[model samples]
Target: MPLVTTTEMFKKAYDGGYAVGAFNVNNMEIVQGITEAAGELNAPVILQVSKGARAYANHTYLVKMVEAAVIENPNIPIALHLDHGDSFEVCKSCIDGGFTSVMIDASSKPFEENIALTKKVVEYAHDHGVVVEAELGTLAGVEDEVVVEAGQESYTHPEEVEEFVSRTGCDSLAIAIGTSHGAYKFTPAQCTRNEDGVLVPPPLRFDVLEECIKRLPGFPIVLHGSSSVPQEFVKLVNTYGGAMPDAIGIPEEQLREAAKLAVCKINIDSDIRLAITASIRKHFAEHPDHFDPRQYLKPARQAVKDMVAHKIVNVLGCDGKA
Candidate 1:
């Protein structure tokens, strides 16, 4: 099938009690790895690109790579999305450029301003047959160009959701409920150490999520910064000439629970980076004489495929859901 909007996907997920994985794509390997797994598993997937990604790989290159995936995997549904678009121009650019969906992240702005900005993008996107996703509350942590301090992070006010969605006409709502961006979601100070010496981050404010669900009944909810940084990958990276300390992410069980709720889209990007980094690190360590990019990237791509497949079957529960 051709690239599709998240409308039908979200409707199905909301009723089926599952969320579709929206994996961020940067280069050819990452795009191939994600879509290859989705194709094998017969799952519908979203290939999202950030502004940073567009700058790094060039917009045409990224879109063509996604187009190649679509052609190769004709059986599974794929949606091209713009992740965390901060302005109306970027959302409009993606809509015109070929994305099936775009997110207008005006959450950092004042409430009225956010609604106004989101509504502006929604108008353009809907007219062009593209779907819009908008964020309500601010999320803490850094991802690409988005950086918010912990003190500044605010959970989505359930009371405002109805008004925001009604006025903005957003197709999906991304709410902040303790999940943050990047590899280090929580600092050690905010978490307690478990018996295994791992830092246990504070639990998600499910109460807030539940309240939002109650207010926006049947509307698709979204979760950003939802990657569960697997400890195994972290250790692998650190063991082989890397020095990332105390990196943590949301737990898998928690994300699984969220998927079974009203959440229809879960954004995961850091995990793919970690997986690729770990595999390349291991490959370099084992083959000091091999300098070709493909020598290492081949294994790195395989690692990504494995990780995505695991998520499809276990966390997102969208396997065979195409």
Candidate 2:
């Protein structure tokens, strides 16, 4: 099937109490892994391209790769999206370049400026038959080009959501409740220790989310930086000559609960990166003579596939809902 906008998908997710996974794609293997798993499970998927991804793998290449996935898996729906678009030009380029959806993340700007910029993008995107997502709050952590310090992050004010949506006319809204941008989402000080000596991050502000839902009433909501940062992958990476400490993420149960509410799209990028890095690290440790990229990338791709499948069946709960 051809690419589809998130309009119908979000409507279904809102009614069905599940969210679609928006996995960021950087390369051929990553695209193949995510789409393959989604295809097998008969789930609709969103392949998102970040500005860094467009810079690393040219925009044409990412679009073509997603188109190829569309051809290879005709049974399930696929949407190409631009993640965290910071400017009108960025969102317009994606909309004109065949992306089914785009996000305008002007949350860091003044409230009025954000609404104006998002409304501009929304006008352009809607004219081109595409849907737009806008963000209202700043999320903490570093993810690609987006970085905000811990104290600097602010949760989405539930009071402002209705006004933002009414003025911007964005198809969906991405809000910050507690989830942040990267793998190291919380510092050691912000988290407490669990029985296994693992750091448990602070719980999400579901009260805030519930208030937003009550106000928006049937409108689609989105969660950015939703990766669970699987502990297994962290241990694997550390064991194989990598050093990353206190890399925590939002708990999966919290995300699951959010999905059952108004959240229709959950952005997960760090988990894919972690899965790939962990596999490549382990492969290099086991095979010292491996030089060809494919030698390691093949396994790395499978790691991505496995991780995405787990998310589909377990975390997002969108399997068989295509």
Candidate 3:
């Protein structure tokens, strides 16, 4: 009923071959949307908060909102998580502030430094009945509070995973295997449709993933910037007079395949944002006189709920696994 750690969720996902969706929450609407979807699907969910989000919504408000979701969804497991924590202080703060899990993402630092930082957080978190996730290879996405230039995008080195895990003792490891952050993951030049005119993003580097699995064995792996940008959401946004500039994400099939492997947590955020924006845009276009916040926000919340439900059914593969 209360917030739990990701340890059990990752273990079950590893054994069940379904990755739990870690959807970032910025406000009450997003939290309500993500938890309601997961609850309806009978799936365990992770409500993650990023540093930018904490600053935007305030940390106390986000924590209280997730607590409220727990009270509302007593049948399903809900984990409050800190996403992409960059410092010891950040991770420690979250661990102390009632987050069930916290990610100490020091992958951009030197290898030794990353291990040291992760170990520190893990040691502290374990003492407090919390779980810790650490990133090995830096992802090339522009998620809130985590911005890396495209030039910096690089796949996780398989050779280092074993050592990183052995030393850090993190409960889960987030890896980068060609899935970058943000909606504009690829350009039109990088993709072309088949005979059926279905979209096909560039293939994920499964070879690298294979190598990581070979090194870590059954260790839980995570995928960040994992939002599968729904074409329907994009259509809604564009039709309502918003330009997204050909945003794309990793295909759902690839994510499904990864779920069957070591992946237990798939981070998603951009899709939720896109869904809210689309609904709000349409409401404004249709109701020019609408001024009350709830007039448009209510529809936006419903749209997010629908989007998350679709994701639980179509992506992440967490349905019926609560």
Candidate 4:
């Protein structure tokens, strides 16, 4: 199938009580890993490109890679998306550059400014047959160029969603309900130690999500910064000369619950990065004599496939949902 918008995918997810996985892609291995897993599972998937990704890999290259994935996996639905387009110009570029979906992240601006910016992008995107996803609240953490300090994070106010959606005319909305970007989603002070002294982050604010659902019935909701940050990968990184400490992420159980609700799309990036990094680090440690990129990246790509497969079956519950 050709690249499609998130419209039908979200509708099916909202009705079936499962969320489609939106995985960030920066290079060929990551794209292959994600789409291959989705294709094998018969699941719908979204390949997201952030502004940083566009800077890293040229937009033309990224789009061509996604097109290649589409040709290779013809059985499942796939959408090429811009993850966090910070401005109307950025959104417009993606819309004109063959992106099936784009996100106009104006949550950092004031309410009126956000609506105006999103509305402009929506008008342009809709005319071009691309769908728009707008964000309402700010999430704290670092993902590429997006950065928010710990105390600066704010949860989505359910009271504002109706007005925002009505005026902006965005196809879907991403709400910040305690989920954050990057591996260190929560600080050590914000979490409690478990029986084994592992840090357990605070829970997501479901009450706020439920209220938003009440106001926008049947609308597709999105959760960004939704990576689970598997500890085994963290352990492997640390074991192989990496020094990341106190890195934690949203629990898969909580994300599973969110998927069964109004949440129709879950963005996962850090987990894939962690899986690839850990695998590469381990490979290099074991075979220090090997210098070929393919030698190490082969296992790294497989690690991504394995991690994505787990999320499809366990966290997203969209396996066989194509």
Candidate 5:
């Protein structure tokens, strides 16, 4: 099947109380891993490209890869999206370059400026038969080119959501409700020790989410930085000569609960990166002579496939939901 807009996917997710996974793709293996898993599970998926991804992989290459995924996974629904688009120009480029969805992230701007910028992108995107996603609040942590330092992040003001969506006419909204952008989402100080002495991050601000749902009613909501960094991968990376200490992420149970609400789209990036990194590190540690990219990348791709499959069945609850 051809690429689809998120309109139908979000509608079904909203009514079904599940969210589609939006996995960021930068290259062939990542695209193959995510789409292959989504196809196997019959889950609708979004393959999103970030600004850094476009710079690294080139827009044409990324689009062609997603198109190949569409061919390979014809049974499931898929969408090409631009994640965290910083301006109207980027959004317009994606829309024109075959993306069925684009996000205009102007949450860092003042309220009025955000609305104005988002609205402009929304208008152009709609005209091109594409959907627009907009952000309301700043999320902390680093993801490619997007960054917000600790203490600078802000939660979405529930009061402003109604106005922002109404004026911008964005198809979906990404809200910051304690979920952050990277693997090290929280510092050691922000978490408490569990029985295993693992630093457990704080709970998501579902109260804020509930208020936004009450105001927006049936509108589709999105959660960015929603990856639940699997500790096993973190341990594997650290075990194989990596030095990522105390890297934490949103709890899967919390993300599951959010998916059961109005949140119809959940963004996951860091988890994919960690999975690949851990696999490659472990492979090299075990086999010191393998130098070919495929020798390592094959296992790294399987790691992504396994991680995405786990997310489809466990966290997303969208298995057989194509």
Candidate 6:
């Protein structure tokens, strides 16, 4: 299948009561990992490129990688998306460059400014047959260039959601409930103590999530910062001589529950990143003489594939969703 807009996917997710995984991709391996997993499970996927990603890997490379995935996985639907485009210039560039969807993230601005900016992007995007996702609340996460400090995390205001969507004319809304960006999502102190003294993070504010759903009704909702910090991956990182203490992420059960509601798209990136890092660390620790990047990258790629497949089957509930 050629690249498609999220319109059909989101509608199906809303009607089916499941969420599609919108996995962020930066490089060839990352794109391959996500699409391979989605293909095996007969799942539709959204591959998104962040502004930082465009800076790291040139925009042309990112677009071609997504194009390659479409050719490689002809059976599953793939939506090439621009994640967290900060300005109209960025959003317009992606839309004209053939992205299937774009996110105009102006949530940090004042309400009126945000609406105006998002509306501008929506107008241009719709003209080009692309769907747009607008944000009403700020998510507390650090996905590359998007850095939200600790105290800045704010939930989406239920009161303003309708107005934001109506004014911006967005196809979906990205809201902040509790999930944060990156692997180190919570401090040990912020989480609850488990039986073994390991910290289990607090459950997401489902009440707030429900309120957003109520405001939007059946409209598609998106959850950013939704990675599940797999403990096994963390342990592997530590065991292989890497030191990342108490790296945590949103719990899978909560994500599963959200997928059953108005959440039609779930964004994930950290888990696959952790998998690649852990595999590389383990491989290096086990083989000190290995200098070939491919030797370690191969296992890392497999790790990414495994992680994404797990997210599709367990958290996002996108398996066989295509």
Clashes of each: 0, 0, 1, 0, 0, 2
Give the number of the best model, judged by lDDT: 4
C-alpha lDDT score of every prediction, in listed order: 0.95, 0.95, 0.89, 0.97, 0.96, 0.91
Q: Candidate 4, residues 1-322: lDDT per residue as tens digits?
A: 8999999999999999999999999999999999999999999999999999999999999999999999999999999999999999999999999999999999999999999999999999999999999999999999998999999989999999999999999999999999999999999999999999999999999999999999999999999999989999999999999998999999999999999999999999999999999999999999999999999999999999999999999999999999
lDDT for each residue of candidate 2 in 163-225, tens digit (9 for 90 to 100):
999999999999999999999999999999989998999999999999999999999999998
lDDT of 3 by residue, 1-322 (tens): 7789988888899899888999999998899888888888999999999999999999999999999999999999999999989999999999999998999999889999999999999999999999999998887768876888876877899988888888888988889898988998777777887898755788998998889888887789999988888888898899989998678888989998998888888888888898999899889999999999989988898888898887777777889999
lDDT by residue for model 5 (1-322), tens: 9999999999999999899999999999999999999999999999999999999999999999999999999999999999999988888889999999999999999999999999999999999999999999999999998989999999999999999999999999999999999899999999999899989999999999999999999999999999899999999999999999999999999999999999999999999999999999999999999999999999999999999999998998999999
TM-score of candidate 5 versus the correct structure, residues matched by position: 0.99
Between candidates 3 and 6, the one scoring higher on TM-score is 6
lDDT of 6 at 28: 88
- Candidate 3, residue 163: lDDT: 86
- Model 6 lDDT tens row, 1-322: 7899999999999999899999889888899988999999999999999998899999999999899989999999999999999999999999999899999999899999999999999999999999999987787768888899877888888899999999889999998888889998877778988799887987888888899888888899999999988999999999988898888889899999999999999998888789988999999999899999989888888999989998899888889989
lDDT tens per residue, model 1, 106-204 = 999999999999999999999999999999999999999999987789999999999999999999999999999999999999999989898999999
Off by over 4 Å in 2: none
Return the TM-score for each candidate structure: 0.99, 0.99, 0.96, 0.99, 0.99, 0.98
Model 4 off-target regions past 4 Å?
none
User: Candidate 5 has which clashing residue pairs, if any?
Assistant: none
Give candidate 4's root-mean-square deviation (CA, Å).
Answer: 0.5
- Residue 280 lDDT in model 3? 92
Clashes of 1: 0
Q: What lDDT is obtained when candidate 2 is compared to the true structure?
A: 0.95
Question: Quick one: ranking by lDDT, best first?
Answer: 4, 5, 2, 1, 6, 3
